[model samples]
Target: MPTLTRRIRRTAATAVAVAVAAGSALTLTGTAPAHAHTGPRAATSSTVTSAQLTAGLYQSAYSERNRVLWATSAVGRPPVTRSSLLKVDPGTLQVQAAYTPPVTDAATGAVEAVYGIAVDDEHNTVWTTNTRNDTVAVYSQRDGRHLATLPGVAHAREIVVDERRNLAWASSFGDGTVVAFDTRTYKEKKRVTVAGTQPAGLALNERTGTVYAADLGGDRIVEVSPYAKEPRLIPTGDGPISVALSADGRTAYTADQAAGALSVVDLRKGAVTRTVPTGAGALSVAADRRSGNVLVANRAAGHVTVVDPRKGAVVETLATGANPNHVTIVRGTAFVMDKSAVGPERQDQAHRIRVGR
Candidate 1:
C-alpha cells in the first residue's frame, strides 16, 4: 500500500491536461497551498509514547458515546476474503467485540473487502465500504448483526457518516464520484461527481453539510455540497492522499504524500493559505474536533505530527512503528495504523499512542 499513495503523481503539464479534458475538474483554483504563515509562531514540540492495541486492523471508524473503535481486517487487498471487523476499546487497548460481515453477493460469493468503515452511533449501526464488491454494508454496531447492503459505489475508499443528516457517504475512487445513501434503509441519496483518478479520502462537516474529497489524480481538494450543482474544486500540493476539515469548516488540511507536506486550504476563500512541511510520506490526516489540532501520519518518517492549523506549524511529533499511514484520535488517545498492515499478526502491527494536551 506504500506505492498506492504514488498512484497519481503526474507532471504539472500532465495534470493540466487531465483538468482540461474533464471540463475544469483539475483547473487550478487557487495558488499552490502556502507552505508557511505570516510571522514566526511559537516552536512547540511534543512526543507520544505508545503501545499495541491489538492486531487485525485497517481503516478505522470510532464511536464517541460507546467509547469503541471499529477497524476492518481483510484477507486480500481487493475482494478481501475471510475478513472481519473488530470493535476495540480505546482506553484499555482490548478488542471488545468482533463481527464478520456476510458475503455481499451470493452468485459470485464475493466476500466483503471492507476498507472504509464508519459508525452511526445514533442508530447503533456500522457502515462499511466493500471496495472489492462495489457495495456498502450496514450492520448492528451493538451486536454485529447484518442489517442491510447497498450497491453501486465503485472502488470505495473511505466513508463518512453524517449524523445530522442521517446519511452516509462513500468515496468511489474508481468511478470518480462520491455516493451518499440513507443510513437507515440503505437507500441511494446522491452521487457527487468529483475530480481525480483517485479520491483517496473524504472529510465531512455534519454541521455545515460540507464534504471534502482528497483528489489524488487531480492534485486538489473538491468541496462537495448536496445542494450545489457544481463542486468547489481547489488545487493543492502534489499527491494529496487524505483530507481533514476544521471544526468550523473554514480550513481544510490535505496530506500530500508526494510533496511530503500538509496543504492548508481556506475553504471560504477557495485558496490554499499555507503549506506546512510535515515529513516524508504524509499519507493520512485527522482534524481533532475538540482541540482544533490536525494530526498527520508521516509514513516514511515513522511519526505523527500534531499540527496547529492556525499557526501553520507542527507542534508535537509522536514516534511510532514504521509506515504509519493512517491516524485517528479516539477517546483522547491517538491510534496510528501502519500501511503495511498484515493479518491479525502482532509482529508487524502498529502502536496506539496517548495524545497529550
Candidate 2:
C-alpha cells in the first residue's frame, strides 16, 4: 500500500481542474429507517463521476446542504513533510481548491503530519490534527486560508470541534487521554483520562455535548460527558478503532479494527446491543448521522460494507482500491482513501463509491 502522503501528492494538481467543473452533491446509500440508511447503490449505475485523484488523505464536509470534500497531500517521507489541502465537490467528485496550511516553522515550511481533518460549520473553520507536532492547525473553510496553529496538544490523533461551544476534543494516542481545547483561544481546557487504553478515533454528538472516543489499545469504546465533572466508561466492542454517532444521539457505532466486526452501543443503556461481521481489516469506519448507516472500509478486502445499525446486518458492499484506509460519508457519496490500489505511475486513481436513494 502507498503511504497516505504519497497518495495525496500524486493527486494534488488534478484536483483543482476537477473542482472547477464540480456540481451537485455525491449520493451514497439512501437513508435507512428513521435511524438507518440503505446500502450504496447498484455497482453499474449512472451516478458515476470523474474523480480528481490525489495521494494523501481526504475528509468530507457537509456544508450548505451540499457535501464538499477537503483533501490534503503530504510531500517527502516519514518524520516530516509539506502538505496542501484541496476542496472537492461530492457531486462531481472533483477538486475545487488546493490549499496550504500555516507555515509555522520557516525552517520546516509544512505540517509535521496531518492525520485527521475536520470542519466547524458554525465558525466556518477547518481544523487538522498535526500528529507529528502535537498541535491542531485551523484554516478558513470558505477559502482554504490558514488561520492559526494551536500547539501543546498531547498526541492528538483524531479531532472533532463543536462550534456552538467553541471547543474541540482530540483523542490522544500518546497519552491515552482526551484533550479539550477552546477553539477561540486555541488553549487547553480539560484533559480527561478515559477508562480505555489507547484512544484512536473521535466523534461528538454536539446536540448532547457527548463525545465518543475509541480506545484501540483497551479494545473498547469510551463515552465522555462534556458537561459532566467526570466522564464515564461505557463498554464497547473489542479493538474498536473508529466511532460514529447517530444524529439523534441515541445510538453509536464502532469499527472493531482488530476483530473485523462492527459494534453498536446504545447511549441510553451504556451497553453494546449488537455485533456484526465485516470484511477483514476494517481500518476506518463512518456513519450518516441523518440516516444512521454504518459504513465500514475494509482495508484488506478492498471493499466497503454498509451496515444497517438497527439490525447489525451487512446490507451492501462496494469494491474499492487496495489498502483503503479512510472512509468519510457526506450528504450522498462516500470518499475513501485508497492508499495502495493506485499504481506507482497513476497514484491519483481512486474510485468514488456512490450510494444514493
- Give per-candidate clash totals: 3, 21
In lDDT terms, which candidate is top?
A: 1
Write down the lDDT that model 1 would get.
0.71
lDDT by candidate, in order shown: 0.71, 0.67
TM-score of 2: 0.80
Lowest summed lDDT across 10 adjacent residues in model 1 is found at: 18-27
Q: Residues 1-357, candidate 1: write the lDDT tens digits.
A: 113212322221121111111111111112121222222432333334433433445677666545566777665453445677777655444456667778756765557766678888667788888877778889887788888878888888888888778789888889789888987778998887754457779898877777888999888887788778888888888999899887787788999999989999987788888899888999999887767878898888877777778888776666666777588765345666664433244422444554445
Candidate 2 lDDT by residue in tens digits, 1-357: 125423443544232222345442332323221112234433322132334356665344444312356665554554455566766664455566667665556765554556677776556677788777788788787777777777766777788887667788887778778888887777888788854378888888877777888888876677788568876677787788888887788888888887888888887898899998888887778886545677788777766777777877777766565667777765446667666524443444334555543
Quote model 1's TM-score.
Answer: 0.81
* Model 1 stretches astray by more than 4 angstroms: 1-56, 104-110, 195-197, 330-332, 339-350
